[model samples]
Target: MIERRMNPHEGRSVINNGVKLRGSGFCIHMFYIRPVTYRGRIDKGQKIGEMLPMQRVYPGITSHVHVQNCNRFNVTRYL
Candidate 1:
């Protein structure tokens, strides 16, 4: 499941989106992006969302997506 919401942690206008993968042992929250998938079973490599235009929001700032694990553990080992 994916839901769109404002995330003050990112910024006053930044969006904090959520993607819940049930039975997969983890969930992910995507910051600075807009969700394309609201609710459904998504496969690997499927398009779930797109990065927001941060350049317009924060001029001269780096444009990137912030992916965080809801489990509060480092996922670098899995990568």
Candidate 2:
């Protein structure tokens, strides 16, 4: 599942984009990056999207991606 919704934490127009890899039991949430892969099987090392320049969205914040190893069934536990 790919999430493209308003960030609840930010409480603004900021979108929280991310990909939930159910098969692999993990999810990758990205900030300041545009997602290109919408619906399909993503292979390893596949180009999911282009990384946006951090200066535009978050000034002074380091450019990086947030990854979480989660339980596919539970959806809350980070294991």
Candidate 3:
């Protein structure tokens, strides 16, 4: 899997529970989840689909993640 943050200066960490992506201004995070193939047999344990925004992923968590041009986020333990 490959995770790329548009802004590398942002602070991020991954705890036991989930991944943490943080940034002050506009931040773009890209996640790449790959399938494990063995002997021509592919294994995709979880359902893969379009990636949703943080708000959609964690409903009721934050009504608004960004305020104007300033954006701050630290999502923890959401795996």
Candidate 4:
């Protein structure tokens, strides 16, 4: 669904499930939704592009760190 900002200065945005997004302003967050199933265990999951946002105020340079680790289960047992 497309969402319009109340103030035009802020700019408008569009969001849809499992779809990429684009807009005029800086993208602080970008992600995707997907279903994960492992060993008959199923769950809804989100894939985030950026785990943290970094911006330089003086130079007006903005950037984001894209997370690459996709490991969901790392079990440890002690007996």
TM-score sort, best first:
1, 2, 4, 3
Clashing pairs in 3: 17-77, 18-77, 18-78
Q: Which pairs clash in the backbone of model 2?
A: none
In model 1, the runs with Cα more than 4 Å from the true position are: 1-23, 76-79
Predicted structure 1: lDDT = 0.63
Name the lDDT value of residue 5 in candidate 1.
Answer: 43
- Which 10 successive residues of model 1 have the least lDDT summed? 2-11
Residue-wise C-alpha lDDT for candidate 3, range 1-79, written one tens digit per residue:
2122232223441210111233443333323211121112213453322322445435566332221112435444433
TM-score of each: 0.64, 0.51, 0.15, 0.16
The local lDDT score (0 to 100) that residue 27 gets in candidate 4 is 21
TM-score of 1: 0.64
lDDT (Cα, tens digit) per residue for candidate 1, span 1-79: 4533435265355544435444355676666666676666767787877877777767998878877766768977899
lDDT (0 to 1) per candidate: 0.63, 0.51, 0.28, 0.24
lDDT of 2 by residue, 1-79 (tens): 5543212135443334545443454554444445676556767687766655555467887766655444324546545
Off by over 4 Å in 3: 1-52, 63-79
Worst 10 residues of 4 by lDDT: 1-10
C-alpha RMSD of candidate 3: 13.4
